[model samples]
Target: MKKLNISVIALAISLVFSTGVMAQGMSKKDYKADKEKIATEYKSAKAGCASLSGNANDICVAEAKGKEKVANAELEASYKPTRKTHYQARVAKAEADYTVANERCDDLAGNAKDVCVKEAKAAKTTAKADAKAQMKTSDANATANEKSTAARSEAKTEAADARKDAATDKLNAGYAVAKEKCDTLAGTAKDNCLNQAKRDFGK
Candidate 1:
């Protein structure tokens, strides 16, 4: 009787441990499935955006494609068990910065518009700096050579800055259009319209 009781207790403990392990395995599987689903949705959105016409449509498509890339990267980052948390945190920060920069650009006019555009560019620059810093830290932690890491960081920063400048130019053009439209407005309406344009253009 004593032997039988001991055997039963051992079996129960084994079953409990096995169940916990299986649950953990299932959780990981579920995470992968969710990531794949998100990537699929992003791909579909990218394809749909590509079908539109005109400069506005082209910009819209490009933005959608960029977003898709980000989504896919995030999904890939998730599967990297060792660095998943860190990469995700970095992505979140970068996204937040981009959003704030875009909103800032949306609010400005004339010289103020140019200044706002510059501010937005600066915001993007900061985000790129943070990303490069993070990359350098990662490379350092992985025992990469200092020269190689520095070179890569510099290249990345330069590219990001160039892109920011291009975006600033586009914002300046948009502000010009808004200014032209403001000429037709009158008195308080004109002032208000211009103010709103400045706010939108990041003046």
Candidate 2:
């Protein structure tokens, strides 16, 4: 009787351990699958943007593709999944702002084009600000907990935002100058000139 009782106890313990291992394995597999799906979606979104044409279309497509890239990168990031989630949400909001600004650009001409570019610039600025805010929050949390890895991640995020902001500022400034020149022209020539400027400036 004693032997049988001991055998049963050993079998139960083995079963429980096996179940736990299987559960962990499943969780990892699920995470891997989710990451792949996000990447696939991002690729498809970018490809869809390629179909658009014209200045507004160009802006729309570029903004769409940019967001897609950001989304894919966030998915590939090594930080905790929760942090990735927060970053993606902020990126999405920024992308939405870009879309709205692009649409507003459609009605604009000359100085109005400059204004539209400024609107897009403002959207980008806000996005960078949001990213910085998130980084600060992450930094504070990491510092409080003394997590070197999290602090490093936050620093990297902030650096990326800074670089992006700098590039965008340069582009917008150039666009403003070009749009001013376009404003000096008149009629269809001005429209064509503005379109060319938008294309050349990658606006």
Candidate 3:
């Protein structure tokens, strides 16, 4: 159990590093090379497992396959650079750990082995749930950010429109006052004053 726990922790750490290539923007050539490397590593690991026997060999083989699965998932995640891809990587790690843990259970017997298998399954379930929750939270945060930016843009537009309205209202009021003053003038002078108000206020 202790060894399994350590393996789980180590897997988590390795997975975190495995996807670092995503930030670098991996190309098709690099991705292909990485896949080939992973396959070679898997073959080597399997060959190493041949030295073991019975349940031990089974456990070793399971671990080798699990690591390969995780490597592929991580490589895909790195190439895609999407939330769903990263979540897939996390799921892969969970499945890999669970497989290794399940195979190890073969070494035990009766209720103890059953318990171990159950614990492994539970661990896998929890990992998947956590990954899902993280993905949802990231999606929610992205939505919130978009909404916040939209709200700010709308506020700016509204403020600009309000300023234009205020300016128009002020000009209209000034024109009215100018026209009332023109009422005191007579004939041509009155006409000229109203013309000036009209021109000044753009009426």
Candidate 4:
């Protein structure tokens, strides 16, 4: 689990670097060569997964596939550098993490499994919400750069709204995870757990 966490972190950091470097634009030749390199790396990763068995193998394969998908998405963003591509790249990373997490949850049973899945989903929701909010904020800021004082004020308002919406989304997802945990309890315990979740999340 620790290893996977570290690997995911490393991949995420690489993605951040790729975004900054790739956004500057790349030659067609360089883009094509990078795509080939990504493909080679993916093949190597998948091959490494083949040595494992059962759920472990499944997890390994999922990680390999997730990395490939994320890499491709990042490459596209680097080549295009559009707001849409950047958003897609972020979504890809979120989904990749969720997939691997859900796969890892297969090692558990009962309420624990359920909680694991819920937590993974909550993480995905939080990531996606943040990504969307970032895109919106970026758009607003860019527009603000080209407009008058009123437009700047409007941009600020839009950015604020975007962040508020993201916070709400993350809060809702947290509540869901908390509620899922509550299912493990009975009667009054469950009721108290749910109430706490609602209060904590402002739900």
Candidate 5:
């Protein structure tokens, strides 16, 4: 049953990733419930391992724990749907695979075991690096978008100020033309024309 449980867990995990969007709309409560279910299953799976002994039993226990952890991480990622959480889920799977691979490596001897361990570590390293890179890229894009939004707002404010300044300059130029026309008159007539220009242009 332990072996079968492992198979089912692996299949479910595969399906979760393959389907890609199944976790998106899931509520936090549902995700939490699923988490409890996985934990209970992990305990049951571990209990089944008591029937075995030696490295066989160790491998079984490791697989159970790893699957439980990975499943929880994946579920959490779905619930929160953040870049960091998604990265964590991917990292969890990589670590789980590494643990299982290392346990399996115990079955080998000498150079074979050495090779298996190296391969397992390499796989974990590569997967972790990829996860980190993706998270960094996502973060960078988010930051750039924020900066771009700010820049656009700033540009809009600057443009508005420019238009206001241009309008003031245009009003002043019109007032200057009106004052010149008033200069052509004399006495009370010229004084009245200049007053009107000042009122109209707010000079």
Candidate 6:
């Protein structure tokens, strides 16, 4: 599922980059029709979840809603084809996955469920961090292109900083997940787990 989501994101980003100013090719009428189509699909998808119950129903509903949001975000990115819109699309995907994952984690109990939720959150944080870094890099590069050689150097530095920050955020999120998992243990075992996590994540 993660691989599939990554593929979808890759495809969306590719499409977004390939069609610079895609709105120029799409008529307002066409965009409106596409939007309506997306809405109709979402409604149908949500209705399909009615047959399910309990956690199954919850998961189904969350998946339906997530898909709808991701579709809308992707559509908006395609229509506008800007870095910000692309970033928003990526965020929508991350949030959608996080929502579905959290719903799925409902099947677990106690510390296991906590760990699942934390892992899901960590995944979302990582995705968002990467998306933010990409957007910042793109913005900086664009600015550099419009300015002097010094601006190019500055953009490079900014890009590196963005990546470094993203890495830090991802590491911290992973550490949180690891720490939550340690709650399943006790005494020295839990302590050892936490210490290992700290060491692994360079706390």
Candidate scoring better on lDDT of 1 and 3: 3
Can you write out model 3's per-residue Cα lDDT over 49-161, one digit (the tens) per residue? 99899989998898788888888888888788788988898899988887877877777665556545656665676677667666655665555557887765665555555
TM-scores for every candidate against the unseen true structure: 0.36, 0.42, 0.64, 0.88, 0.61, 0.88
Q: Which residue ranges in model 4 land beyond 4 Å of their true spot?
A: 1-23
**Candidate lDDT values, in order:** 0.50, 0.54, 0.70, 0.81, 0.67, 0.79
> Which digits, one per residue and each the tens of the lDDT, describe model 5 over residues 1-203?
12222222222233132232245768767766776777787898899999989889988898788878877787777877899989998898878877877777787665456545655655566566667766765665556557887765665555555455545655655565567557567999989999998999997
Which candidate number maximizes lDDT?
4
- Candidate 4 lDDT, tens digit per residue, 1-203? 32223233223423432333354588788788778877887798889988899999998988888887888898888889889899999999999888888888888788778878888887888899999999999999999999999999999999999999999998888888889889999999999999998888887
What's the C-alpha lDDT at position 157 in model 6?
100
**What are the per-residue Cα lDDT tens digits for candidate 6 across 42-80?**
798889999999988998888788877887787788788
By lDDT, highest first, what's the ranking? 4, 6, 3, 5, 2, 1
Give per-residue lDDT, candidate 5, residue 12: 24
Model 3: worst 10 consecutive residues (lDDT sum): 9-18
Backbone clashes under 3 angstroms, per model: 15, 0, 0, 0, 0, 0
